[model samples]
Target: MNGRMIYLIGPSGSGKDSLLDSARDALAAQGCRIARRVITRSADAQGEAAEVVDPDTFARLEAEGAFAMNWYANGLSYGIPRVVDEWLSAGDDVLVNGSRGYLPEARRRYPHMLAVLLTVDHHVLRQRLHARSRESAEEIEARLARNAGFAETLMTGESDDLCLLDNSGSLAQTRERLLKLIAEHRLPD
Candidate 1:
């Protein structure tokens, strides 16, 4: 039996990294492996635990077909190592911190993948972004605008494969919701 793909996506500062970190053990106990991304950024970057690579190295790896999936966003390149394919083939569910813009391509490749959108209340999101201090106030506003539109579209869309997980509350609540969502979508043996 092939394992299912759980594609988790959300705008920056929506707590994707935090949720993944907090729920890592629970997810593993449930037979799910979170794919560590190869990103073109410093190892000490303030975000998810991703493999850091130079732009040239990333380009070379992409050319060599080392990634199962890859895309460029926010001035950085992100890749999911091809090992994920092997994990899924071995009947281990795989979760990826994926991109919203790359959803179409991901869906095309993994037709049965569950697309989970982690959402937060606008005020909470703004506060998180401000606390992160990764972007200027203007940039944060622009991102919030974009997130609002994209979120609205997703919420209203009739996509059966899409799951909306709100992360507006405590990390504990979001972690429980995440685990439950995984259980609910687990593939039958």
Candidate 2:
């Protein structure tokens, strides 16, 4: 059978990274192949655990057609490298960490792609961003406003299906729910 892609799309402070980390380890234990995304943002701002890629090199890779899908958001450029296509082509499902703004384009490209929107209450989002402290207060407020509008568009988009993973609960609880969904849907791997 052909493989499919499961994309996790959300705002900056919606706990997308944490949820993905937990889900990745759990899915790996069950034999799933999760794909890591490359972004142009500074590694320091992204946190200590993220893989680092130079923005210039990422751009070069894109120009050389190394990415299956790529886009810019929030002043940062993000790309799903062609290596992901190689994996999916080889019958391995790829769990991609992505931005909500790219959902419509992604769906258009891969009609069968499973898009999951990670969500948290606005208050929670504000608090989380504040904790991250990567952006100044004013910048954070601007992002939150833009993120709100982007989230709405993603939620209303026409696609095969849209799954919402609420991230307000404990990390373990969220991971459990994600695992359940993957199994129930028989998402490719």
Candidate 3:
């Protein structure tokens, strides 16, 4: 059987990176591999452990068909390496930190993929974004508003493969819930 794709998406400050980091080892033990994304950003950027590449390099890679998935968001280009295809074909589940706007395309590509939406309370999300210090207060507020709208849309037009995981309180609790969610979706042998 082919392995499932867990496409994780969330707002900027939703703790997707943190949850993925905390659950990495456990997920690996359960045969799930996290795909390291290639992004057009600095290596020292304070977020996910994505591969940093210059715009030229990213263009080259994209031209060469090195990515199974690619999208531009927040003024940066992100790509999921095509190696994920190999892992999936070998029966190893793959999890990707994915884009909310690009989700429809992702779902089209992997129809059976599980869409995990990591969410946080509005206040908690605001605090977290502020703590990052990346965006101004106005930008953060705008992000919060967008997030709220997106969450509402998802709740109303939910799909069978979509799952919502709240990351507002404790990372430990969220990690446990995430593991359980993945386990529940695992394909039977």
Give TM per candidate. Answer: 0.96, 0.89, 0.96
Candidate order by lDDT, decreasing, is: 1, 3, 2
What are the RMSDs of all candidates, in order? 1.2, 2.1, 1.2
User: How well is each residue in 45-142 modelled by candidate 2, as lDDT tens digits?
Assistant: 75524455788888789889988888888777777778887777777777888767677788887778878888888898999999997889999999
What TM-score should be assigned to candidate 2?
Answer: 0.89
Clashing pairs in 3: none
The sequence of per-residue lDDT tens digits that candidate 1 reaches over residues 1-189 is: 399899999999999999999999999999999999999987767988899999999999999999999999989999999999999999999999999989889999998899999989999999999999888999999999999888877777646679989999999999999999999988878
lDDT of each candidate versus the true structure: 0.93, 0.78, 0.92
The runs of at least 3 residues in candidate 3 whose Cα sits more than 4 Å from the true structure, single-residue gaps closed, are none
lDDT of 1 at 49: 85
Q: lDDT tens string, model 3, 1-189?
A: 299999999999999999999999999999999999999998777998889999999999999999999999878999999999999999999999999888889998988899999988888999999999988999998888888888778777755668989999999999999999999988878
Error of 2 at 105 (Å): 1.6
Q: Give model 3's TM-score versus the native structure.
A: 0.96
lDDT (C-alpha) at residue 116 in model 3 = 97
Give candidate 1 regions above 4 Å deviation.
156-158
